[model samples]
Target: MQQLRTPHVVVVMGVAGTGKTTIGPLLAARLGVPYAEGDDFHPQANIDKMSAGVPLDDADRWPWLDAIGAWAHGRAGLGGVVSSSALKRSYRDRLRAAAPGVVFVHLTGDRALIEDRMSHRQGHFMPTALLDSQFATLQPLQPDEAGVAVDVTGSPEEITARAVQALDALSRPAK
Candidate 1:
């Protein structure tokens, strides 16, 4: 395996149930780096609001996003992987601005599969009822964004492999 550089930041982003938590740690291990669960950065109020089945407005999300961005920025070359429900293009932009050259791995799956996963999962603040609003807020990442899109429908091992492969490719020396 090619030795991976500390990427500054790696954003494992997607809507709910996209396996950011499941896959991010393995990716971090593969890269020989630290990882952060982006959910940990959310304020208690945001969690309470989501648990109550209320969707947050952009005003509600901006600060939380900024906080996660700040955490990513703090690591610099030490590198870190962060799992987040970065459901909008603007959110990704803000995060990228906070830490330049941040690589985003977007985990995506069909609505039915995602909804089923969300419905069955436990202990998360995000309720199944609020999924539609999240989808509504999501803007697909542009080509210019330094990122990769992975389907979350497969096994955790498979997802981790794909993510590592993508990161490896990005870290490769061009011939």
Candidate 2:
């Protein structure tokens, strides 16, 4: 398999319950590139708000998203993977602006399955109760946006395989 970072950038995105955390690292490993968890860039305040079951406003997310985008942009020549919940078109637009060649992988799954995963997950700032708000705000990637949308109902390995295959197909040659 080709290395993940061989391309400019890859952003693994979806709602809270998707397998971004697992898939991002696997993709990174497959591609021999570094992996960054976008949530790690969020300010403490954002984490506190999400943990409190309050959804973040755009103001709350802009800086965080920008930080992640900048990181990806910085590594554009080397390539990397970022795991993020970029639910809005504007947020994605901002990322596209920051990292020109960044390709997005959108993971989607049944709401019930997502909720179950969120409920069972631990140590995440986003609470299960806030999932509805996230889904409500989500705007799937437009046709013009460079991305691949995939189902998240399968096993992590299977999901990773699918994601890797799609990314390999969609990825442009590294600059």
Candidate 3:
């Protein structure tokens, strides 16, 4: 397995059904790092709301983001992968504040494709009805962010390979 040049926490971020849950572990395995499921950090109330097809507002997300941030902060310099919706710039900023050197992998795909995936998936708290809110809230990675945008159009392994390649590029020093 390959490893990151530096042990920075990798946050696999995207809207629901973009495969963050599926790809995070695969990417972590490929990079020889530990994986954390983002949903595990959510409070039951937040989960319950989403399960009812209610979209979370910032008020509902702060605690959850803080929890995930704490986990990322703890894993700093140890190389770990965690998945999260991380929809907004402010959310990513908050995460960066907690874990300074953390990087992100923003998964991208067509809405129809994502909705299809969500509809077919089972046992997830997030419902397909809230997908529009997810997409609306998303702010893609900016030029200054220490990360890469990867397409989620292929098999998990294929997507993982693309993410690995993108992350490797990010790790390279500018000439």
List the global CA lDDT of all models: 0.83, 0.87, 0.91
Residue-by-residue lDDT tens digits, candidate 2, 1-175: 2223356688999999898998999989987889999989999999998888899999999999999999988989888999988999899999989988788899999999999998898887788888889899999988778888888877898998898888777665655
Report the lDDT tens digits of candidate 3 across residue range 1-175. 1223488899999999999999999999998999999999999999999999999899999999999999999998788999998989899999989998889999999999999999999888889999999998999988877888999998999999999999988787775
How far is 162's C-alpha from truth in model 3 (Å)? 0.3
TM-score of 1: 0.91
TM-scores for every predicted model: 0.91, 0.93, 0.96
**Model 1 over residues 120-162: C-alpha lDDT tens digits?**
8888778899988888888876777777778887888898898
Candidate 2: the clashing residue pairs are 3-31, 4-31
Model 3 stretches astray by more than 4 angstroms: 1-5
* Model 3: lDDT of residue 116: 98
Q: Which residue pairs clash within candidate 1? A: none
Provide the clash count, candidate 1.
0
How many clashes show up per model? 0, 2, 0
Question: Which is the better candidate, 1 or 2, if ranked by TM-score?
Answer: 2
Number of the predicted model whose TM-score against the real structure is largest: 3
